[model samples]
Target: MDGVTIIDHPLVQHKLTIMRSKDTSTASFRRLLREISTLLCYEVTRDLELTMETIETPLMEIQAPKLEGKKLVFASILRAGNGLLEGMLDLVPSARVAHIGVYRDHETLEAIEYYFKAPEDVVNRLVIVVDPMLATGNSSIASIDKLKERGARNIRFLCLLAAPEGIRNFQEAHPDVPIYTASVDSHLNEKGYIVPGLGDAGDRMYGTK
Candidate 1:
């Protein structure tokens, strides 16, 4: 838990409860995820550097705080990550986007990369990787690995739910990157699912198997 921050806002907790219910419809689940993700994004980027810029309101000129340096990058880990991506983008529309396509191999739970596209200026920007569940940590780790390989130094990981096992694995693999999640669940089940989790996030979000 040293490197993890839990977003426990009342709104976030309330929405997460509804998302966890199996009775929730896909449309409802998706809507709640987008809403919760915006809150999570607020917490994760709380410490972003700000610079003062002169701006004119209607009457007079004033110095207002603006984000410093390059636009931050949101590197979403494929399909499920896109759910979180949509809402975060809603909050930071000017932020750059990166999509890393990595999937966990069911048998080994290893991450396999199929596609990757990112901004060429990643080396100087803060990159936040988003995924709904950090069950095994394989895909998250692999996606960050690719980002680092491309010269990304400042990085963060964001997820809706995280298993203790996955948190430990991800921290051990990439201790420098901080993790942000709504809840760190009890543990991972035998099939690599988080115990008491909302089930497969991608499946539930998209009504897939």
Candidate 2:
């Protein structure tokens, strides 16, 4: 779809296939999740702003560009988001990390925040809210709302996969923030699960079963 980033890297696609297989072992699943996230991290940070400065080479000095500002505050939306967070850290080792835990109300389908914390100067820094699944967007929206309350206007949503309905809902609610996903599949199922999604990101990631 337009305005959506569906990463089509061969490696990502291949790993996703393995992750999707019910026969895959938990160890393999976890490893692939990390690998895919690292790949997506490269794509997600491609547009980050940069400034040029003089640098010294062995022979001489030359102007070069490096990442600027306060680096980034990656606010992981708990358990599942941690999957992507670890990989992101590998790429942005100096980035500040925070946590905000939110859960879904099975009956009401509303997001409930049980925990929230952030960096001291989160607003001035580039912020990224990450979770692997953007199912109904409630959690992402709520997490963003909390971050905004703390003065985080500059933000991005990173998900490994998304459902069209959730994407629409999130875009409508927070039109200002852009979303990044490895893939956006079809509509959600009757029970609200994104069809063909890697089932229950939290459960899958943690081997809760």
Candidate 3:
């Protein structure tokens, strides 16, 4: 709760409900994710620093405000994370992108990394990690760990759905990093799935199981 922000905007909530329904078509699900992500981006970037620059607008020159600092990096956890990535890019087209591939070992429920790529200036810019579900927190923690290893000091985690267990675990592991999500579901099922959550975000978004 301390390091989390729940985006309860009506539009986001409405779209999430449609996504949860099992009857929704794959095309609808993908489109909804893209739309909801735009709203999430608005909230997450609310506090970005602004600077003034002189510019001429028709009649006279006046100081105009522009975003300060280096381009922010959106580090997406592979496969499913890309679903959110597409929409976030729409809002911040100039932002740098990073991809991290982490898979869960079904039996042990541990995260294993297979691929990772990031910009050389990652350490200097703010990094926002995107994932669809925070069920176990293992992947989220591991992915952030990899980022820190590469000198990333400022980081944030964003997901569409989260579980109490996952939230607690993620906070304990990375208290400095804030979390943004549309909903914190009731709980995680025995198989590490969020209860009442839209089933397999990756599968729903891409029509793949």
Please identify model 2 stretches exceeding 4 Å from their true place.
none
Candidate 1: which pairs clash?
none
Ranking by lDDT: 1, 3, 2
lDDT of each: 0.95, 0.87, 0.94
- Candidate 3 lDDT at 52 equals 100
**Pairs that clash in candidate 3:** none
Q: Whose lDDT is higher: candidate 1's or candidate 3's?
A: 1
lDDT of 2 at 100: 97
Clashing pairs in 2: none
Candidate whose lDDT is highest: 1
Candidate 1 residue runs with Cα over 4 Å from true position:
none
lDDT of 2 at 12: 86
- Kindly list the per-residue Cα lDDT of model 3 for residues 1-209, writing each as its tens digit: 78899999999999999999999999999999999998999999999999999999999999999999999999999889998999999999999999999998878889999999999878899999999999999999999999999999999999999999999999889999999999999998888989989998988988886
Each candidate structure's TM-score, on Cα atoms with residue i matched to residue i, is 0.98, 0.95, 0.98
**Error at 33, model 2, angstroms:** 1.2
- Model 1 sits at a Cα RMSD from the real structure of 0.7
Worst 10 residues of 2 by lDDT: 1-10
